[model samples]
Target: MTRPRIVIGNWKMNPLTPAAATTLATAVAREAGRVVRVGVAPPALFIPVVAEVLRETRVGIYAQDVSAEEKGAFTGQIAATMLTSYVNGTLVGHSEARRYLGDDDERVAKKLIQVLRAGLEAVLCIGEREDEFDAGATEDVLAAQLGAPLHALSESDRDGRMTERFVIAYEPVWAIGTGRPATGEHATAATKTIRRVLEEDGGIDGDAIPILYGGSVTASGAIEFAKAEGIDGALVGGASLKAEEFAGIVRAFA
Candidate 1:
């Protein structure tokens, strides 16, 4: 069966102290049973510590990113296996990684495979740039991004085993941390398209894949977006930094 909706907080680069982690954990524990599933992706330095805090709570801890390689001399890279050992989960193909760190489709595909091998769920992100959106290439871009990696999955990888342990986040690159979000209608349309692509290309059922919206998501915006046609949940940014605000977004899904 398909998993329930998920609300994920991407605590990107903020909260530099243990005190901040404690506050967020307390808030998540307070609202534990309210939502279907809630997760927080803290900086790598805090993954293990946060994992411990949320262990008794319903909230899951996720790594911001993971390397496709199992192990290497590659300095400064955290492998998926290491993430599974440290964090409760991992996010792959975030836009920032694609834009700044140069993670391409092939890299993302490899990371997804590694995440699966490591026995940790992976969150795959896909979105279009501002120029692509203006050029009406939103659907095309999403299809290409999602299709490439999925199409690369081997027959052994499709044995119904590896396919079920992942989620997809549709984070419009134009809207990320920019204070502007894609309209509810636009978000819905994009998610629907993503679902269709999964079904058509990956042989994944539309109902089985959890498609999330990410990009300037807030507590106030959660209800409207959650009410959207195909949005399974959200990958929140700035709003997620605050415990109260992030908890509010989780409650919106409830």
Candidate 2:
């Protein structure tokens, strides 16, 4: 089967109020159903308001992050199980979480397991930093970052079909939020490395998993990135906050 095209808006810490989030979600719901799959991740606190607006639409609700720990006294952590009631899926190992929250590969692996077991799709984010790219170690960095999580996959989870729930978003840290998205050539190459590791190292069907290009994606460049070799869709950030602009991107991909 061919990989399905998808676009997910990560409204990370934006709008600053529940009323704003509800309005954004309502706007997004209006633009839904044109794309194969469209999702939005509001801040954890605003998930309910967004979910209420998107209730019957084709658009899905996602969590910006999830806890590696199942449950306990982990202050400020939202367990995967807890999110199952509110969201269809969750973003794991995002660049922000890695850089600011200190979610390394091991923790990411555990969180991936938690998400899967909780019956939620997991968007596994992996990429290299600017320094790593400057050092010509992009491929190596990508492979290493993916290693722990893939190895953490159970034998049953590697059965091809089950692996479909896992999507990869290659967001080069330097490119994110910098207005300098990776070129089509650069993204294609990076995704190639990601696919190689998924198939060769993880013993899974790489083509079955959708790999997305994230970081500073905008309407003007959406189609180019969407049509790039090996890219299935986008994991949008800043540009997603605006309804019209985000709709333009969805139309581009559609």
* Candidate No. with top lDDT: 2
Tens digits of lDDT, candidate 1, 112-220:
8888778888899999999999899999999999998889887676667655677999998998767666888999899889989988998877678888889788889
Root-mean-square deviation (CA) per prediction: 1.6, 1.2
lDDT agreement of model 1 with the native: 0.84
Runs in model 2 lying further than 4 Å from the true structure: none
Give the lDDT of residue 1 in candidate 1: 59
Give all TM-scores, in the order shown: 0.94, 0.96
The per-prediction tally of clashing pairs is 0, 0
Query: Tens digit of lDDT per residue, candidate 2, span 1-254?
Result: 68888899999999799999999999988876665689999999999888888888899899999999999999999999999889999999999999999999999999998998888999999989989988999999999999888898888766655575789999988887665667988999998899899888898878788988897889998888877989888899998999888887888777
